[model samples]
Target chain A: MNANSKTENRALASTVLELDVNNHAGVMSHVVGMFSRRAYNVEGIVCMPVGYEKNGLKSSGETSSEISRIWLLVNEDARLEQMIKQIEKLEDVLSLRRHGAEHEVFERLEEFFH
Target chain B: MAANSISNQKEMFMTSKRSEILTGAQIVVRLLERQGVRLLSGIPGGAILPIYDALSQSTQIHHVLARHEQGAGFIAQGIARASGEVAVCMASSGPGATNLLTAIADAKLDSIPLVAITGQVPKSMIGTDAFQEVDTYGLTIPITKHNFLVGSAEELLEVIPHAFRLAASGRPGPVLVDIPKDVQNQSIEVSDWPAPGASDPAPAPDAVLISRAAAMINGAARPILYLGGGVVHSGASGSAVALAEKAGLPSVMTLMALGAMPVDHPLSLGMLGMHGARCTNLALDECDLLIAVGARFDDRATGKVAAFCSQAKIIHIDIDPSELDKIKTAHVGIAGDVKAVLGQLVPQVEAILRKPWLARVADLKATHPLRMPGIDDPRMPYGLIRAVADCLDDEATISTDVGQHQMWVAQAYPLRRPRQWLTSGGLGTMGFGLPAAIGAALAEPQRTVVCFTGDGSILMNVQEFATAAEEVANVKVVLMNNASLGLVFQQQTMFYGERIFASKFRGMPDFIKVAEGFGWQTLDLDNAGDPSSALRAALSLPGPVLIHASIDRHEQVLPMVAPGAANKDMIGG
Candidate 1:
């Protein structure tokens, strides 16, 4: 995957596109490919399986026991809106949430590193 | 005590009467049979031998052995795209699985439903970087709708059904299942048969949004219905025409939605965006209400995003919710199946007398009609497309490899039925035509299947020529050889100050000799003296025939809206 260009960060605000996708092997690749295919770079990505304790949670009728939440960080632009639409179209992606710069996940990570 | 009871319950479930003793390979074959698959394409190899051994005993399915796994993947895609059902492809570990990647990615981009099954090295040897072991799961992640690396035979049973469901369900795409070699040989009691993949219901459109859209349609002086690929996916072509005719709005067909409405419809603004007709783009710019259906405002479709429809109030209708405000924010967004939403919304929209708007559209058409070079020259790409389209059936499935030839087919082919024009619009995959044409022919044996290809694109999978002949597919190959990557050459000439790079080939193999070598009857258009007589003979051939039409490299696809330029500002008009 190509690293996000530094020039994209020169904007005043960056938005984090948080997606809830089915916990399957290819979900992350599809999401990243959608962005890269359009030349839209994702600066930061954090993806993990939601639950490991309960492997037999099949009574709810869900196919997989785990789900993945991926946060994509990028500077906001007019193209970002369209990118989100394409991302939301992914079959594995269940839901999406948009976070402004005020979202603490990235800020906290910066502080912890310091 | 609790742990003991849990183990006891699990043992009981495993030994139930409904269970049958079967090898892992038998389970795989049985699952595919249950999914209603009748045909498959693949090559046999070491890792997948167990499954093939089991497959030999099954009479329910027929497997067409393709020369390459990539060809097999495309054969499956052809079936899926033609039948609107899940198609299956199989391969072994390592290179066999890797070769299938291109077709899988092609299916993903085109939204064709396919399930690719592959054999993996033993589970224990997976991460040690064992011989013939590749990270199949890791490598396939981005290209598939979903993928599974089954840990056991029991998991295999669970994953197969879901894999079919994911591939065939909402926004259909390719899915993959990689099973280890040992798992295929393992025998187990079938404890239970899992339920078939669940069917997803088309989402109901929000009533309020529909009403708002109807109001916009009723109030607007100038409106245009922009159709996209989703319309074909949803089988909403009838609804698309109904909405347009009822509201009396001009409709601009996107590249993917070419046949959604008849090409001759009075209000039809023939293909819109980059290589779109100047009249269509002008009508789009002037419209006050832009009703976008099943189409994303892709960069190719929207020349300059900011100025695409500056004066228009957008109403985006799509099954995929994210597409609602993805490009141009919809003034009224309907997130539901295009057919269902349009079904309800069409009746609510008041009919209008948009005489002035229609007149403006007509005027644009009269003033700046799409012009083709060498209308009388049969050697030209556009002229060849027209000649072939005339010779084929209206319901014929036409697939094209990516390049200048693809754009010409999109522009000139007289498409009469929805889902009849298949091309790599999203990812623009070269080498897609021959394999896809094979797939299409296999799916609908009665319909004529034609593949329009370029020299550069066809060479990408030129070996598939054998697969076409081997399958005895009724596919005709119209090889338009420019001896160079024509699209790239055009781009370089127009944009990059004409510093020609490696786009041209000095010592290319003679395509006719290669086609004949592949056991296909070859015809050189230049040698025939009369193009029409040669085309007639080629089209009437029994099996796969190649019509090699060589043209000058300088010929370019015209009416190009340059990147970042407004739709109205076009060169080569």
Candidate 2:
């Protein structure tokens, strides 16, 4: 169980960069296609809509004045910083940030119906 | 003047020969009708407007405009599951097709036969990223069992029948047909009709492997039967029960295999999982050998893979070859239809007299009996369910949405026939109960059909209540109204230290008023009286009925094998 702890953390690995597209028109769809076809660097991403009010900003090239946010989780490295730069250029995109490690891999469950 | 007149004649001739002509609306009906599609459920969109216009004029087939495309997909699933026949659904190319994804995925997981036909933008502009021209073929491949793109009018008839067969055959799932606009507008000769029965996938049972499985089961001292959804899909429910009855081995169903055995039967252990009965888990733990039929060891079924029945010699049988030894190792691996294999295994088990094994399994059941906690009161929720089951015959079909009510039905009802229970198994899609039960009722109107759903699940497609009322379908909806998302809140209470985040819905409208609003006679099961009178009254009251039973908020389904715990370690009060 402690094999990884005993071993060194010398191997270079990537982290996920999340984008919150707020169900905005074809932003996330185009983004996913771009990643799959063009970037091919981001791995294991999940995106859904959040509120633009929380971020206190507006998206670019959106036909509607009402702004929306999208949450994306990506797996990368310094590449995350670079991907952020590219995603910012897309219209109808407000702000993108990495949701840091705060999740728990469910260990002990007391419930019967899961 | 003579030259000009000749030139005009030549131009007229060339214009007549320009490509081929097919009316957009006529193309839609011809492709579907020629393939022998008798039933289709969907709301028509602009992209598919022409198709609907054509279908309206044709009285040969029936087209039902579903309240939502999602409901359309589920209804198609119900028809396919009951009849084992392929059902069709039509939707517009873009937003319409996207809405149908959940249902398609549901059909894929449960192995239901469905052919979802979506209209696409014209083929003239192949990939300019044109309007309503989403790559539906590519999007549905991973989710659907199979998919097709019809590029020409000639292949229209060819694709339709092939789609029907491909979806109906072995390990059935949804197939998507993306018909381009240009093809729909072309006229073509149809002298040769493509026969509709060419796509059946029959994975024949291996006779040698069946005998080998028989030998293993015949020799084991203590054997237990584990069943899953494939048993239901493969029509192997009879063989499953026969194997259990012959060997005197206790049978446990996965969530998907609820109807394989009558719940009240002595040999039947209701379900085996986190919410499984204590007796069922104990049976799994104590058995000397485990005979898994048409069941892949899902994580929910096997909480901790390493600790799951480690002492037992496992024998696995499945139609899919890769499933063998994928999750857990098997002592004997047999790939074939479970029914065929079990037909051979029954006689072989008769030869082996494993009295000790039977005694041990019975002992295990005796030691860990799962008695419902609120058994003393007649008004108890479980008692209410038992009353409902008693009123309906064993042959009646039951469909359920995922929740506490779903588990309650599984723990209580006794089933007699095969393909009588349809549900969302692998992907527990909510709002599956009412529409699915409607389809089941339509498939066999004479038999009593009942659907059990929670307030949360029912709200997902509450409009279908009107559909049930509108259509001459007799479906009884038993709404377990705790006025909460019972399953979600139950898990949060047990696991999240009772934080109670986003699962509360207390002060709602009078459920009776709501049901009556939908034109359903509502019955409030307030106390421990016989609900049979209300049920009888509703059965005669024209169409569908809703029985709303109020249950406790904190009630928990027990015998939990915690996430990553062994089957033997299941905890129940």
List of clashing residue pairs for candidate 1: A26-B141, A29-B142, A82-B326, A85-B322
Q: Write the per-residue lDDT of candidate 1 for residues B172-288, one digit (tens) a residue.
A: 789999999999998998857777665478667899999999999999999999999888888999999989999998998888788889877887888999998888888888889
What CAPRI-style quality would you assign to candidate 1?
acceptable
Q: What class would a CAPRI assessor give candidate 2's docking?
A: incorrect
lDDT of 2: 0.72
Candidate 1 residue spans exceeding 4 A from truth: A1-114, B1-18
Instruction: Calculate each model's fnat, 2 decimals.
Output: 0.43, 0.00
Interface RMSD of each: 5.1, 16.1
Best by DockQ: 1
Report every candidate's CA lDDT. 0.85, 0.72
Q: Runs in model 2 with CA error above 4 Å?
A: A1-114, B1-36, B125-133, B198-203, B375-378, B527-532
lDDT of 2 by residue, B218-271 (tens): 777767889988888788887788788877777888878887776667778778
For each candidate, what is chain B's TM-score? 0.94, 0.90
